[model samples]
Target: MTSLWHRRRQPDDVPTPVAVAVSDFCRRAKAAATPTEVREALALLADEDDFRVRSLTDTEPERSPLGPFAVVDILRGTAPELASQRQGCGYYEVVRELARVREEKAPPAPAPTGLTFAAPPAAPSPSSETPPEGSTARAGKSARQAAETLQSRIAPRRREPLAETEPYEAEESVSFKRALPKPRGRFTQVAAPKASYQTLLHVEGKGILESALAQNEHRFALLKSLSEQYNGAKGELGLPDLEGALQRHELMDRLTSRERQGLLAAYTEQRGAAGRVAWSLGLSPSELQRLVSMLQLQAEVEGVRERFQREALGTRHLTQRLDLLGRDKYLADLGIKKRFTEMLRKEMEDLARGELPDAVDLPGLCLAIARKHGAPQELVLRALERLGLSEGLRKQLLAHSNHSSP
Candidate 1:
């Protein structure tokens, strides 16, 4: 009876008893993945000793190596280990293989497309200036001192936006309007070539120093060489021949993309800044900017005047012609508008520079200045009214006019 029972249980057909049990477990696991997929994975337990046999979930490091377990116990279904692995990254290959072994009855998957991507470039690291070598090591937080040192050196009047070389605190707000110091000579500055060369060498290291000086000198020399260039081209458009255009192009192309932008920005800033300096010394950028504009306007006016005379047009007609060239509804209005715009740009520059524009139309200029300075427009108007400043006197007020006490 025992031999008959053994034969009934051990019929030799498809699967062995052990394999059948495993396949059955896998089939049941496929329903909801018997928590064994999370079990330390085959890859985690994969080893070199292929001939060495071992049961699944056995910690046979000499044979399979590593853990034969995942976060949770398969039979119990609790994963305390995975909670500790939150910081680890994923490896989808192991997860896919596990799923495949468990769900064999499912249809085959489509071939995958291969994709490759490069990592992005890293940001520039902060420049660390090691303070004089053997001196007592400075506190890490002393970056404020370095920032103050830098501010005292080059950035105040250059009107540069401040950024630090190291970690630093935010700059506290201060009144932008301050009284101008007593004027010396021309508000315009003429940087001595030799002195400028020295300044460049001192500020920038040897690499850019000579190059920057050479670039500046080249521009200056180009202007000198093409003395007749600004006279307007002789070929109908009044444009100059620009004989040194090649030199300018070469100089510009030699600069890096960033350097070119910085150079142009600096020049524009300097142009506006010089005008403001002139304003602080009792002149206006409007007059300077307008001088160039008016020079062209003068020729246009003269030509139109001749045309009007030859055609026997009325005075109103000539004035209208000027207005048309200037693009104003009325000639007189055009003049006024040009003057106002010129003055506004001038005053705007002044608000940025150390001084303010003189009080012309106190309320109007004040509002313009206020807008430039990011202050309330009505506040400036109200202040002007309270001060009882005459139109002419108001015109005398500098951009500093906003600061009541100062």
Candidate 2:
């Protein structure tokens, strides 16, 4: 039930600099002689707190004749401080003069039309704010009319409706389609054709994206296949899938020393003819002759070595037998003395004939003879030394005699 004036003043009750300025403006406006001066003064007042002043002057020009007296009425009712200030400046005197002049020039009052002037728009009261019962329907009709007016402005009515039939009929009814008639009511949206470059750019972008996706998928499949193959091989070999083992397996070891030597020998001797040689031993004349010569030389050298080993073994065996049995009895039993002398004579003849590979170890040969005959090693060495088997051989026998004395 609070009055609008009280309600508006309640929040802004405390005096402010704007209020003081407003009070000054109101005093000046009241003293102003002409409506022009009054309007200019009101325009200078604070817009936020004095919006009613501007509204009364600008929006409702019909109320300008009331002058600053109307403004004083509004301020007095709404704000007590500004009102008190205006009163001190003889604000009431100005209002009275204006009222007197207005009454002198006033027209006769018209009969009430069951209508009231709208209350000046401050904080609104419910009773005064409600429109009459029928006004809502009238407002809705006005709004619809206004919307239609706007729509008509945007799209003007066509001068003539489209004809039902085509303007010119073709004699043979051409295959090409005719344009369709315009639709009634709301405007239809038309699609615009895109530029060639824009269309190409979009198509190219889509193609590139699809191509990249396909390539990515192919690469993924390849990697997956390789991974499966590797894992299958590892399982077959019973190898652990340890980290970094793939790199270690890739680093293969080189051929060993014996394998390298055998490979070199095979390469040197066989060259490119190994396959032909294996298929048939039928060789060219030069190759065949060289092969026979090499075989003969190898056989002769091997035979000599074998004979030398057999002689040494036989001499040792004879020595052991002579030790077991007296030499004369052994020699008489088998005539070994004559056989031993003949063998020694043959060996000496071979050396004199230069049939041996190198100078023979005469001391070693003589020692073997001495052992076979059951004679002292020193007696054998002294006999070999007197036989003049070179100075080197003499020195060798002397060392051997001393070593074997035990």
Residue 113 Cα positional deviation in candidate 2, in Å, after optimal superposition: 99
TM-score of 2: 0.12
What is the Cα-based lDDT of residue 129 in candidate 2? Answer: 77
Question: What's the TM-score of each model vs. the native?
Answer: 0.15, 0.12
lDDT of 1 by residue, 283-358 (tens): 3445433433423344543344344333322323322322233222232322344443343334334442333344
Q: Count the backbone clashes (under 3 Å) in each candidate.
A: 13, 0
Q: What overall lDDT goes with each candidate model?
A: 0.34, 0.39
What is the total number of backbone clashes in candidate 2?
Answer: 0
Q: For residues 240-338, what per-residue lDDT tens digits would candidate 2 score against the true structure? A: 221123223331111122223332343234332333322243344354334335334335333433453344336644334323232333333233455
**What's the C-alpha lDDT at position 47 in model 2?**
44
Which run of 10 residues does model 2 get worst, by summed lDDT?
1-10
